[model samples]
Target: MTTINYISAVTQALEEEMERDEGVFVLGEDVGARGGVFRATEGLYERFGEERVLDTPLAESAIAGVGIGAAMYGMRPVAEMQFADFIFPAVNQIVSEAAKIRYRSNNDWEVPLTIRAPYGGGIHGALYHSQSVEAMFSSIPGLKVVIPSTPYDVKGLLKAAIRDNDPVLFFEHKKAYRLIKGEVPEGDDYTVPIGKADVKREGDDVTVITYGLCVHFALQAAEKLQEEGISTHILDLRTIYPMDRTGVVEAARRTGKVLLVTEDTKEGSVLNEAAAAIAEECLFDLDSPIERLAAPDVPAMPYAPPLEKTFMMNEDKVESAIRELAHF
Candidate 1:
C-alpha cells in the first residue's frame, strides 16, 4: 500500500497502465514536455519517450479526434483536456463520433479511449476554468462518466476506464489532486470495477448521495452530524452515468431521508437523475421530501472569492442540509 495524493495516484495509474499494455499512450497539450498543466503526467514523457507521450497542438477537438481515431484503429489512447470547461470544443467528437461508433456499428468497432480532465472549483480557476461538466456527458448513452474522490478510487477507476472497451469520461476534481490523499494498492492487478458505488459511511438517519470532491465534504458532514446523534450514510456514486441504481435505492431504504449533493449547478444537474431514481423506486422508504444541495443556476462560477465560496459546495452547507432533512 502507498499513501499518495490524488495527483500522484493518477500519475501512478498512467505509468502502470502504460507499462502493462503497449497499446496505451497519453496525448494532450503540455502533457509530454510540460508534464501537464497540473503535473499529473510528470516524468511520464521522459520514461515513455515522445512517441508514447505525445504533445499536440492547442486544439481540443483535434486531441479528441485523434484519440477516437487511434482507439478505433486498436490503440488505447488517454486524452487530456486541460480543464473540464475547455472540453466543450471537443463535445462534437465525444458525443457524436466516439460515443456512437460502437452501437452505430453494431459491436463491430469499440473506442477504448479515456478522456481525463481536471474539473470543479476551489482552486480559484474562475469562470473559464472551474466548471462541473459531468451532467453534460452523463446524459449521453454509451459513455461512462467517472468522478473519483479518493486516491484509491482515482487510480483504480482510471485504470479500469482505460481497459474498458468503450469511451470513459474521467473527471478528477482540481482541488482534490493534492488535497485528497489515501492509501492505494501497490499491486498492478488491482482495479475498482466501474458502475459500482461505495458506501463511504454507514448510517441510518439519512443517506447522502454525491461524487467527486463533494464526497469528501459529505464525509465531513457525516462526521459532524454523527456527533449530534444523527447517523449519515454516504453513497459515493463513483460512476455517474451507469449509476449504481441498486446502491441508490438501498441507501435510501436504509435511511428514511435522502440528501443529493453535487458541485454542478442545480438546473439539469446529475443529482436530478439520482433524485429521480430514488423517487421512483424508494418513495415509500423516504420519510421527508428529497433534498438536493448544489450550486445555484448561475451563468458561471464567480471570480470573487466571496461569491465563489457561495457558489462552491462545502461541508457546512451539506451539514446544514442533512440536519434539516433529519428533523423533517
Candidate 2:
C-alpha cells in the first residue's frame, strides 16, 4: 500500500483505465493540453495522445452531448465540467439523454459515460466555482452520483464509474483533491463497487454520515469528540445514488445518534434523505432526534475568508451537535 494525494489517485485511476481499455477516453475544456482546471488530468494528453484525451471548446452542453453519443457507441467517455456549478448547462443531455437512454429504449442503448466535476466550497472558489449539486441529480432517477472524500475511494469509484453501464455524475470535492491522503493499493485496474459505504472510523456513541470534503472534517470532529469521551461511527457513502441503506441503518442502529453533514445548503439537501432514513428505519434505536450540520442556505459563498468559514460547516459545529445529541 502506498499513500497518494487525492488528485494523484484520480490521475492514476484514469491512467490505469485508459491503459486497460482501448475504448475509454477523456474529453473536456482544458483537459487535453491544459491538464484540467485543477490538473487532475495533467499529463494525460501527452501520454494517451489527442484522440483518447481530448480538449473540447468552451461549450459544456456540446461536451456532454458528444459524450452521450460516444457512450451509445460502446465508447466509455469521462466528461469533466471545470466546476460543478457549470454542469447545469448540460442538464438536458445528462438528464434527458444520457440518464434515460438505457431505460427509455428498453435496454436497447446505454450510456457508459461518467460526468466528472470538482464540487464543494472552502478553497475560496466563491460563487461560480463552488457548488454541491448532488441532490439535484439525486432527484432524477437513472443517474448514479458519486462524491468521494478520500483518495482511495476517488480512485476506486472513478474506475467503477467508468465501467458502469449507466451514466454517473462523479463529484470530486476540490478542497479534498489535495487536503486528504490515504494508502491505495498499487496496481492494475481496481474498482470499488458503487452503493456501498465504507466505515471511515468505527465507534459506538454516534454515527457521522458524510461524504466529499466534510468526511475529513467529520473525522477531525470525531477525533476531538473522542477526547471528550464521545465515540463516533463515521460512514463515508462513496456513492450517493443507490445509497448503502444497509450500511447506514446498521451504523444508525449501533450508534443511536446520527449527524448528516454536507457542504450543500441544508434546505432541500441530501442530508434530509439520510436523516429520514434513520427516523424511518431506526427510530426506536435513536436516542435523540436526527441532527444536521451543513452549509447555510446562502445564495453565494462570501468572499471574505472569515465569513466563508462561518458559512460552511466545520469540526466545531459537528462536535457541538454530537455533544448535544449524545446528551439528549
Candidate 3:
C-alpha cells in the first residue's frame, strides 16, 4: 500500500485506466500543460501527449457535448469541469443527451462517459468555485452520481465509473483533495462498485450518514464522541443517487438514531432521500427523529472567511449535532 492524498488518487486512477484501455482519454481546459487547476492531471499531458490528453477551450457545454459524442461512438472519455459551479453551462448536454442515450435508444447504445468536477467549499473560492452541485444531479434517472471520501475509495470508484456502461458524475471535494489521505494499493488495480456505501466507523450510539467532505468530518467527530462514551456509527454514502438504502436501513437499525449530513443546502439535499428511506423502512427502528446537518439556505458560499465558516459544516458542528442526537 502507498500513502497518497485524494487528488493524487484521481491522477493515479486516470493513469492506470489509460494504460489499461487505449480508448480512455482526458479533456478539459488547461489539462494539457497546467496539469489542471489543482494539478490533478499533473504529468498526464507529458505522458499521454496532445492526442490523448486534450486541452479544450473554456467551454463547458462543448466539453460535455464532445465527450458525449465520443462515448456514443465507442470511446471512453473523461471530461473535467474546471469547477462544479462552472458545470451549469453543460447541464443540457449532461442531463439530456449523455444521461438519456441508453434508455432513449432502448439499451442499444451506451455512453460510458465520466464527468469529473472539483466541488464543495472551504478554499475561499467564493460563490462560483465552491458550490455543491451533486444534489441537483442526483435525482436524474439514467445518470450515476459518485462522490468518494478517501483516496483509496476515489481511485477504485473512478476506475469503476470509467469502465461502466453508463454516464457517471464524479464530484471530487476540492478541499478533500489535499486534506484527506489514505493507504491505497499500488501493485494491483481495483474498482469499487458505484452504488455501494461504506461504513467508515462502527458504533452503537448513533448512525451518521454522509458523503464527500462530510464523511471526513463525521469520522473525526466519531473519534471525539468515543471519548464521551457516545459511540457513533458513520456510514459514507459514497454514491448518493442510487443510495445504498439497505445499508442506510441496516445502519439506522443498528443504532436506532440517525443524523444525515451533507455540504449542500438542507432544502433538497441528497441526504433527503436517505432520510426518507430510513423513515419508510426504519422509522420504528429509530430511537429519535431523523436529523440532517447541512449548510444554511444561503445563495452560495461567501468570500469572507467568517461567512464561509457559517455556511460550511465542519467537525465541531458535526460533533455537536451527533452528541445531541446521541443523548436524545
Pairs of colliding residues, candidate 2 = none
Off by over 4 Å in 3: none
Off by over 4 Å in 1: none
The digit string of per-residue lDDT tens for model 1 on 1-328 reads: 8799999999999999999999999999899989999999999999999999999998999999999999999999999999999999999999999999999999999999999999999778899899998999988999999999999999999999999999999999999999999998778568899999999999999999999999999999889888999999999999999889999889989887999999989989988888889999987888988888999999889999999999999999999999999888
Error of 2 at 8 (Å): 0.5
Residue 94 displacement (Å), model 1: 0.4
lDDT of candidate 3 over 1-328, digit per residue (tens):
9999999999999999999999999999998889999999999999999988999999999999999999999999999999999999999999999999998999899999999999999999999999999988988998999999999999999999999999999999999999888999987899999999999999999999999999989999999989999999999999977789999899999999999999999999898999899999977887999999999998999999999998988999999999999889
Q: All predictions: root-mean-square deviation over Cα?
A: 0.8, 1.0, 0.7
Clashes of each: 0, 0, 1
Computed on alpha carbons, the lDDT of every model, listed in order, comes to 0.94, 0.88, 0.94
Candidate 3, position 53, lDDT? 91
